[model samples]
Target: MRSAAPAPRVIAVVGPTAAGKSDLGVFLAQQLGGEVVNADSMQLYRGMDIGTAKLTLGERGGVPHHLLDIWDVTEPANVATYQQLARAEIDRLLAQGRTPVLVGGSGLYVRGAIDVLEFPGTDPEVRARLEGELEEHGPGALHARLAAADPEAARAILPGNGRRIVRALEVIEITGRPFTANLPSHESVYDTVQIGVDVGRPELDERITVRVDRMWEAGLIDEVRALEERGLREGRTASRALGYQQILDAFAGECTEGEARAETVRATKRFARRQDSWFRRDPRVHWLSGAMEDRAELPRQALALVERAVTA
Candidate 1:
């Protein structure tokens, strides 16, 4: 029933944390009759709700959101898998004559989903070798191995980021090419209109603090306890989230509640800075100041841009 041609358009809402990107996505979806596709990595897990700030049913307002809780904490979610699932969702949305709005702070997932990036298939043998190295030398050592083998990927991956480091090593060992070299060389998959939310540092930091406190009030700690009770530990995907990590620390008596909360806020501010840096590399993104006097105006502006993109 569908033509053998590409879809008309997709809009991606990307920005730093606490920049109201999610709110804008919801508003745009309601206004434009689009479906929200999750692009945030941590938000993909099922029980990791409060820390991820996952939208409640009321927040989504009955709009269909794809790729939000499709993966379990024990499963490994890489870019290749994400790209496949997201493309399928986008295709399905387009077939139904609806717009697809990809929204999140995870720049890597956004790029992988919309760009021509090719993530080489995972190799279990290579993964086993990397896992051995991780056991023998730890995550930092594995990162150093990646840095030596694929400096470009190393630059993007922080040393403490065991997930990425392991992935880089796994790819390099499997494909016999540097992991960074496998990225898309030219052009992207979607004819996307990129929108970035910009907020000043002080305000962003304050927002992070407030959001962390809100998560605490919303039973984020209890959620962590429940996950632990379900056997989702530190190395698991559900536990690596910023809020989850700090709350787990408190749960384990490694830190006081006050100290854990402070650390979580601080980590969140740092993560937001990293997110801004990553999205800044994309020149196509139109920056919208989060400090705008009329916060509600953002959706209208985004809608206008997307309408023009699709119509053009």
Candidate 2:
């Protein structure tokens, strides 16, 4: 058995989509006698299971996973709220003498949980006006405006994500500072160790394709349809989820179902690239291969890193 550290520390499993983060999180949590505090933003929404690649109850191996399926499909995701929830779970686990293992591709949510991040407050008038502009001219136009105001944030945010785009602009207007100003400079709120699962681009693309195909096979269309019946289409945040949005487009006759599937794969690949870029910028993450040959050893490697961190 590993010796206990001087104090409880938080462990984060991070990386691009389809890079085996969730499973690694489960393994680490089990090994460390920990519970998972989910950092995946989309997985917070109820009924987004299959598309978000949420682990099934059996697959979770009886390890407690906090913060999954907490939001309705119609409720917009708030990373600030998620930060609070995740920190509470992490604190609770640590108080119980168990580790807190954080897991997800959602970089901001992960950072918000472990880092000293203070999100800027919103302004109703500014938000309503920007959202009105978004509704009239679409995200593309506001993205262009954001590009002029905060080129770095614009580059980080996808142009098609109108909700985030609006939020970015709103924060800028309210604070008279760049929206990216809200982020911390890798300042940890806890004694934290970040383990990044590194999967190569080619393999990650292949994995994304296979995952999307499997999603279709596993009834993604049916899932989207059911969520639609529950107001997914009107949801500003949930409706824009990678696969869900594509399926929504197909349902609206904007594209063929097959085309939507294809687009989902392509879009997911792009998103994975962005996730990689985001995490790569953080100096704290220690990356371990999630490649096929290295897969069996990842758990050991991650544990070793944690051991080193704890023993240091």
lDDT of 1 by residue, 248-281 (tens): 8887889998899999998899999999998887
Candidate 1 residue runs with Cα over 4 Å from true position:
1-8, 292-294
Q: How many backbone clashes does candidate 1 have?
A: 0
Q: After superposition, how far is residue 257 of candidate 2 from its true place, in Å?
A: 0.9
Candidate 2 lDDT at 87 equals: 88
Task: Report lDDT per candidate.
Answer: 0.82, 0.91
Query: What overall lDDT, based on C-alpha atoms, would model 2 receive against the true structure?
Result: 0.91
Residues 1-312 of candidate 2: C-alpha lDDT, one tens digit per residue: 443544248899999999999999988888889888888899999999999999999999889999999999999889889988898898898889898999999999998999988988887888889988988999999999999999999998988888888998888888899988886788999999999999998888999999999999999999999999999999889998999999999999999999999999999999999999999999999999999889999988988888888888
Provide the lowest-lDDT 10-residue window in model 2: 1-10
- What is candidate 1's local distance difference test score? 0.82
